[model samples]
Target: MLRLHRSALYYVRPLLRAALELTPSKSDTPVTFVPTVAGLLVRAQNENVAIEFTVEGAGSGAPISVPYGSLAKVEGRQHEPLELAATLEGNVFRWSEVGIPQVLSAPALEPAAWPSLPAQDCANDAELLTALREAAATTDIASLRYSLGCIRFRGDGGQLAATDGRQAILLSGFRFPWSGDVLARRCPVFTKLRLAATDERHVGRTEDWLVFRAPRWTLWLKIKHEARFPDVESQIPAREQADTTLSLAEADATFILQKLKHLPGGADQNEPITIDLNGSVAVRAKNDSSSVTELVLSSSERSGAQVRCCSDRRYLQRAVQLGFREILFRGTAAPLFCRDTRRAYVWALLSAEHCLKHNEQATRIASPRAATAVQWANSESNSGS
Candidate 1:
């Protein structure tokens, strides 16, 4: 019997989950049982190098020989003793003792016949490939699992959609090649497109590698969740009273974030920070503790345009760091809309309550009639948050 240390077991669990998620689950024949193992092995390709034993597994009958390239790369002594083991029972493969059980659930068998796709016929692959890379980065290897059937391509351009519940991004422009039956199959496949004779766009077959064409550029990615992405177009605000665009230098934005960093009770629901934008040219943020940070925007028109809202400072900080040229504060009560004019990116909404709690004087700002308005604003912001 092999006994793995608690730390070693923890390390191997996520690795096994990631590997298993990438493997094809549909069995042509009945699979008895497959228990995970952990052990180190010397690379046959590069015998001089050794790899740590993160995860390994075997079927019920014979020992499984995995390719050296198939293993996820980790830093450590390559020649160390690698733990390995496996068991088989019917078609289901379960991890009997891989150290971390919570990291992975038994992967369900893939359907025999997956939903069909049209065909693949595309010229440019830049957009699809880029979107894939961005999406893959948003998810961890252990959390991503999805099957790609044949993709039919048509038109001069195509679009890729990615989402993680909190945020969604859509990139458009590419060509798709259309093929009927060819697009129907459950397997990981990469689609490479020649953006230019010299430039290539590579979309990963799964999340493991970023398949793109560029000289001297190599990228790898982990698989991402394949759940249906959200409908982003529907979330855009329908109307805007004032489209105030301000291009603050990155340094200025950083300064604003720093000043607003410390608010009441940090990010709790009770200790809200108030953002007063209605003043002449200064944006004022104050907490219950009388700590006030005022940022003066470079604007000549002060106009009594002040609106008060509350938010989690951390969330706001992240939004600012995402590099939007102008922060579009739409309607005081809803999530503040931030967009980068240089790129088509929209951030997740921040809640009004989270912002409101920062200001101990939020109730004073709302009247009986205005209470309904405030509630509507908060509800909208909460939905986006």
Candidate 2:
């Protein structure tokens, strides 16, 4: 029987769901479990994404290689196959389900030696993890580019950047101070890393993998093969171009989008909504059968150019759910930069093409903290959100 922590599984659960999204065949998807001196490795790779979830030891001595199906749960030898035994508080989970063939027939990866990486103690572990989580939240898992499916972190000195094609997020001035660079020695280069954050004793990396070592918890992740991250910096619109700025409440933004989804003809993918900021904040949409006009709460910068920013209802709505207190909407066509309002560290952009770029500007939010919501990607990586 194999044993591991429930908390560790919390970190891994999202990766499993993502891998499942990669493959259409859900019935017999394979999951391989392998053990190493560091911890237990839960690995799955499909055409879209290849993810490895690692959990530090629970003092169970050595771990063995085992295979399982997506639906199978850990069970004891005497328990019925219908029952499951797993906990999240670091309790041990017993895996002994005996009925599923795929669970019994999965392949085991050849045991490879782990690489030695530079170990450093970081102070802002939780904040860093939160940043990565924010980035991962904005990533498009369904992207055709295999690299786009995973979260990318390109940091130099203290700056980090991540993007999902349509939108880009940049973060600078992190709190951690290291003798050597975290992901790599070079700066401004992209490194596809697993989303993980914690104040473990030693956090280090090898050429191919990042290893997190805690007394009772551990994570191992394989970095993406591509060395180059997309060039998002060149695409960001300059601050001066924003003809309109708004201080829309995060809750209000969420409420408006949620209500639009309920509108009879407002939620379809093909249906586009015009967020007219020329006057009172409003959402305008129409379909073959009907149309919707809803008032949104937001303060305008000016009545200058009538801004008619058009975007997919769902995409815009999803952007609002990112939980930023306020967002700065530059103008139509140009990307609307979203941020914490209280801090400059976290920021996100609505997809540039889908949202369009360069537009007639008019409208302003009341006293918006000027900044972008930077994308913080999958932390507790190896177990990412």
How does each model score on lDDT?
Answer: 0.36, 0.45
Q: What tens-digit string does per-residue lDDT give for candidate 2 at 100-123?
A: 432222333333333444455344
Off by over 4 Å in 1: 1-157, 162-167, 173-199, 204-229, 238-243, 257-265, 269-275, 280-290, 294-306, 339-385
lDDT (Cα, tens digit) per residue for candidate 1, span 254-368: 4455555543355544334454455433344554555545454433222234555654455456556655545555556544545432133344544555443233332221211
253 in model 1: Cα distance from truth in Å?
A: 2.1
Candidate 2 yields a Cα-based lDDT of 0.45
Distance from true position, residue 24, model 1, in Å? 20
What TM-score fits each model? 0.43, 0.59
- The positional error of residue 228 in candidate 2, measured at the CA in angstroms, is 3.1
